[model samples]
Target: MDTLQILSEQGVLGSTPTVRLQGEALDLSSYARTEDAEHLRSLYSDMFLVRRFDQESTALQRQGQLALWVPLTGQEGAQIGSGRALERQDYAFPTYREHGVAFTRGVEPAELLRLFRGVTNGGWDPRKSNFHLYTLVLAAQCLHAVGYAMGLQRDQLADPSLPPAASIAYFGDGASSEGDVHESMVFAASFKAPVVFFCQNNQWAISVPATVQTSVPLAQRAEGYGFPGIRVDGNDVIAVEAVTRWALEHARSGKGPVLIEAYTYRMSAHTTADDPTKYRLSRDELEWKARDPLLRLETYLRSAGLADDAFFEGLDTRARAAATELRESVRSMQSADLEDRFAAVYAEPHPLVQEELAFFREYEAGFIDDGQHS
Candidate 1:
């Protein structure tokens, strides 16, 4: 199918609309009571800051400050909208490129850089933020999310005082093919785990196009597991948020898991190491650019008079300041001691770990005082 036809079929482009609250030709009442001005402004601010964070990290990688960086430029709406839908008790298991979701979860941008900088395995405590560490291995976190959801179910049954909670597993179209995701869905279905399988179908999984991922829509896979699946216009933040909210609520209420296929496009390279020019067409990129998430929301804000020059100008200033702070923080980060790597290899000292540490020490001792090989 053509790009326009595919997107239109998925409710991402052209005439058939998905749920939306703020848009040029859309009625707000159809979604919910019109979102208050403050709420709308907050959503815009979150998207802007996350985009700035992404840009700063990409620059850092280019400057050799970070080992690698994953850019989430075009997927901001899908991440932010679904992230904001989570309740405080809910948990999220994210793939490496969920900077926007991490932003919504109250994680510091600098902390997220620590892993990419090779300073730590995980930059933050999952318990503290209810956001799991970035999972580098594809689809691994989906299993973890399902297990955690089962635990939440047990806890809720054991203690009535505890609020209902659900878990969200964030993966991409590429990771969906992994056996781990399939196993996770099977276990979740059999156990009726309260987990949401949130797939960001960004069109391209690394260099491979979505056409190669599956012949049918990714959402339809949920039906085989005995659950409902939804396809949302991922670029439409309002629609994403609404759909995610409903999905989360359904799971939290003990209706079992839901799979959300967020039909979106990856406007940037998959990661800093990738070059989209090698595989994707320039025309396709330009077409998706017109459907930019931030631009559409900005249009709604301006049309509704909810935001003005002062608001935009102030937002720009804040985004720039945040980016500067992030860059400086990453550059100023100190490397951990070599011994520190072995310290956490085992909870307690293990014979194998000790032997490896000794070998590492002996290897370091071989270096000459002049910093040349002896």
Candidate 2:
């Protein structure tokens, strides 16, 4: 099968929606095949809380608390879904804006906020949660993922008694245009590395729509590079989790890499700095809002009789509390000192860095506060 590649009458891949590209009707409940309603309800609660965390972080940025904020308001489904699918052994390499996944992986929201607040490059230890530091260089982390998977292959070869592990690289539709992502795919497939290339096709790369990126579906691009690929309704958390779980298992079980193109929409601006209204159509916005992931999940929960008014109200209450806690945590993050700017660069200080540090210290000493003596 050609797998669900849609093209415009004018020769575009997204001219019309395919069965695999349907908005919110993917029926993940069918695929999961479990009746643990409470667990699913908990998933809904976590998703809601993460969305609130995302909003609060954005507000923090606007309030001069954070230097920059990469909003993931519309990407909660893909992030939380895939995040929920991973095993503790699996490692995640994420680009910036993966706040939901970080939350799912047990990263403290305040710690992640530090990166945006300019207090530190990253506040948490990636090894602690198998969640790698956020890579800000577009698609650079794709290469890191492939390299880590290669190491996994090597370690397994070196120790025949070891179990398998998978590594996942999270990137946006825009990062797909980077050479590093493609190169990472090439290497992952050639070596049969245990890696899952999770591409969130949120329809726009900054201001550029996927239409300008490629002619075929993003997921199917894996086939050409020697791996199986699947497209899922990214807004449907069930579908994303199920598909991602299967892909990760396949890779860990020696089936090599899998490319998952999550057909989602970026409902908000690309970042707090960019204006989506300048690049996107109002109709597109309306369409995506109708297909909102959180709302769709809410619908399914209600229709499935797993949720009610009180449940939603309670969730809202919990979300508010969580957001308040996160805000407070951000407020408590310690400001970095001038010396810290030079630390962590090397195990031991280098000559030039030492010189720069000395110069900076002298510069600071020159600016004495009115009556203070140093």
Candidate 3:
């Protein structure tokens, strides 16, 4: 089936989407196929943890522990679902907002917070974690992911005995419009790079609506670069996980890149500084709120008899503890020395850099040695 054609038929005025994921408009019974009661309970636990982390990060930002916080108040399904789909051998490139994904991948929450808090560029090594440094530049990670996938292909060639490694690039709907993203698609397709371009179409790019970014669905654009595209109910964690797992397997098996557009809403302001109300209609907000990811999971869990008051209470307790721990960690992140930033930019210090560092060391010593603000 042509996935692009499937997308074209979706989101049209007054037209029903053929792929109505479980729990889109009905009770939680529909979501039962994806998991048994035990697994559902675990996923709910995961969602709670992610939300707790998000709330703590936000509070830290407001309290001056972090320089900024990009909250994913309503998009936990997309991140956790897509993240859970990745194999340990697979690589992932993430945009800055994918804290939930990082969390699912076992990234230490403290390390992620330190990046936004401005204590470091990236606190963790990408190679060690199976995750790349969070890309603040929109769509740049797409190119990096493509390069990584190509390198994986070369490695597979050098050692024909080795298994192929899939790469996943996470980007937003706004980033889908970037030229580098398009170039990434071109290169991935041309090289048959084993990559999945996972786009979280959260329906807003700060103040810009998805309508303004492109007339067609972002997933359909994958056809232009000779890749299949699948649009899933992003709020439905089951749907997102099922679709991403399928897409990732296809890519890993040498089918090249697949664009999985998880159709979700951006429930929060774009960032701490963004006022979504300035540009978004209240009606749209209300409509999207009704599709809240956590609510859906809650409904499903209750209907399936997978979660009870005890379950919820346990989750709440864990969430609270996590938040407290995260708060402390954010507070404890020590500021890096200013010189360390310049030191890592080169292998051996160049002559000019040596001279500048020497001058700065002396110049800085003249001032108070406390590196509090530096």
Candidate 4:
């Protein structure tokens, strides 16, 4: 199992990154080097902006402006590259930490914060963006993605005019161990569903290291499912984008599902409530920091002269302004009325739920009338 790596730069700054292709990754090399420096620059810009947005979100949680936050500091390469691989018709189902992917899908920074701010159950419309809501329930989105992909298959067969599309399910190494993931894969393989299981193997599942979860490379598991599995350098954004494009193409062509293991690391605490100090070593953090996705891509850009100090400076300015705007949106978010909550409990209003809402409203009125607001 040779890991596919393209921009593994141990070379000094300002030197062009050597493309390292291993295994059967030769086909992906051309895609990685599009000769369009501006494309690479755009990838860097997205990484920079998303990282800034992620940092601001963490700060919001610290300042008590958000109820909680899932930080995607280190996995920007995997998220952004795979996200951009999607065609306009392709749909994506994401786990909770896919804020980087959301940015690629045109989800606003303020929209991404609304859920953590406790102002909304869904941050954005899945139909509008074709990017589903972040599934907080671990690997559950795997099943949903497969079902949706099967539906897409049927939809295309029924109407040849519809564009052929695939679905990509984003989960983590930890979620791979869940039975729900296995079950989803079973159905996908049996039906040859047009789906790509994009696993961002971020080393640890909360406090538990990935070593405790699986003995083999997570990509190897796809072999049992009778599909191609490729492990790519998740920190190398170019490699990730190339590999994901291939996987999406394979699935859409009716070659069955493909599992892509994006071998990356999580630089931040799993969430705002997590404390990495309790379980991980400072040395590990330093080592992964050296392989930081944004830094690696930034080196490639500088070496290629694709961007300059002025461009980066401008991006920083824009990111700061965007964060400020997101903060204001969070602050201005008002809690939803309790009546709306009851209405959402069912597709149609239930008698019992209606009675509960009425009783609660009447009980609240007692405090206001008696001048005993609490």
Candidate 5:
């Protein structure tokens, strides 16, 4: 069946309002009161910094400083809002493009560059920040998140006094097609795992459009798993934050899993190596640009008199400084020794690893002794 017909049949396109707060025509009373002026400005700053960082990373990739970069240009609101909603005790599993989420979780930008620069297998300690490493394998983190949530359930049962904790699994519309996501959701439902399946439906999964990904709204899929699901305007940071906070609370209070389908757009290429112009039309890009997350928040802040030019200026300065620092760090990054790769393969010494390492050493020695074969 066609996507529209399928959505109609499933009643997935029913009148569930997309949660929105800051927009030209939206009623803000329902959502605007939750955050104070300072908090609003902070959210704006977070979005600004993330965008700047994304731009810098893209530039670095273009300049040949990095091997690849996944741009999160149009999805800043979805990432920042949902990311900031997490508690310190909570854990997050991110897909490879969750740069804004990492920023919100206190991950250093330089550390993030380490992975893209090919200097490290993983960047930063997951335990230290409660934010797991980026999973390049599509939909793999969803299963990991569900398992972690089940473990958290067991841990909570052992110590009732422990503070409530939830795990969030971040995936994309593309990954939704993976069997692993289905299995994760099924297990989460059966086990009543305290997890939030956060899907950033950024319109395009590489070159494929959302229309091809599924027939119904991605959020509606949660109902099949016997959990509540909601759609939030992913470009509206206020709405994203409000919905995420509510979802997190529900899961933390033992309500089981919740699915949040963030309706957003991928304004840039899927990655540095992609060319969106080959598939997506310019008119669609223009439409999403008008609904830019950063622009909406900045407009709201200015209209409400919540922030002044000085605040914006200072923020810009900070962003530039941060970008400079990241560039310098990435350029100065030292490559790991070739032996370190072999050494990290096993916790204990292994004969196979030793043999491989020996072979590699002999090969290097042969190259060093003379220009010709030894």
Candidate 6:
């Protein structure tokens, strides 16, 4: 299906939309709420800041300050748009690379590094932001999100006055192949859970291409589960937000879950430990770069005269400052006590935990005479 995109290649909204859903000319154009120049500007600012944050975090990993880093260099639009689309009561289950979503959920940039720095058990408190800690276990969060959505149903039934809420599961094309996604969809469809399955099809899952995951578009899978599905131009931030807002509304309004495939690209390595140059062609990267999410938004904003040079300049300065502050924060961070780390491994203390803590203590004791590992 043609991806739903409000903006054309040059960042101008198309006069006619050719996108389709269920074999119908999909005109979700009215879903876009970016007509207000200020809202569009805010979206641009979020993407710009997220891009800078991603760059700075990658640099930290390269410099040995972080144990590892997941790059989100090319997914600013998909993340920020959908993230901003979430209501305050909604919850998000994210993968490790969702720094852009974390930013939208009010997660401090430096706090995200605490885990990679090995300084804390987790980066941030999920309850504070309603954005869960990054899940590294593939599509496991998809199931968690569905369960949480079901709980939302129970909560509403109990209180009847509580604010309506939904859940969103952010996974990738690679994780879409996991059985967890299938099970989650089954349960969500069966229970009419309020959740949105958001797949950021960056095309590669580590070294594997998305083609290996599915022959058809990932969004189309929602049909078998008995819900609506749509493929949106993940590079178009406005379009993403619009689609996500509609999905969230559908989910919480007693309808079944929706599946959203954000068709975008990953401009960097899968992680600091990955080397995309080994698998992808440079020319392909160049072509996608032209469809850069930030560039299109900037183009639209400028052409419409929504923002001036001073506004962009201010954003640039803020981006640099944010990066600088994050670097300082990471450099100053200290690891938590080894005991604390072991304690957080499980909800309850176990013999294995004790054995591991004991081993660590013995190892540290061996280094008592010398400031080096035994």
CA-only RMSD, every prediction: 4.3, 4.2, 4.8, 3.7, 5.4, 3.1
In candidate 5, how many Å is residue 206 off? 0.5
Tens digits of per-residue lDDT, candidate 3, 1-374, equal: 11111223344322232343221322223323455677667766777898888888777888887778898988888888888878888999999899888887888989898788888878898877799998999999999999999999889989988876899999999998899999999999999999999999888988888888988777778877887877776776766766777778789888899998888888887888778889989898788787777887898788767788998998899888878888777777788887887787798878888788889888877775475534
Model 6 misplacement above 4 A: 1-19, 370-374
The 10 consecutive residues of candidate 1 with the worst lDDT sum are 1-10
Per-residue CA lDDT of candidate 4, range 248-359, in tens? 9989999989998888899999999999999999998998899898998787677778889998999999988988888888889887888887788899979999999999
What lDDT does each candidate get? 0.86, 0.82, 0.80, 0.86, 0.86, 0.88
Q: Pull out the clashing pairs in model 4.
A: none
Instruction: Output the worst ten-in-a-row residue range by lDDT, candidate 6.
Output: 1-10
Error of 2 at 279 (Å): 1.3
Clashing pairs in 6: none
Candidate 5, TM-score vs. the true structure? 0.90
Higher-lDDT candidate among 4 and 6? Answer: 6
TM-scores for candidates 1 onward, in order = 0.92, 0.90, 0.88, 0.92, 0.90, 0.94
Which runs in model 1 stand beyond 4 Å of their true positions?
Answer: 1-12, 19-33, 370-374
**Highest-lDDT candidate:** 6
lDDT of 1 by residue, 265-364 (tens): 9999999999999999999999899888899789888988899999999999999998888888998888888778888887888899889989988888
**Model 2 lDDT per residue over 210-229, tens place:** 88888777876887898877
The better candidate by TM-score, 1 or 4, is 1
Question: What lDDT score is found at residue 205 in candidate 4?
Answer: 98
Off by over 4 Å in 2: 1-34, 371-374
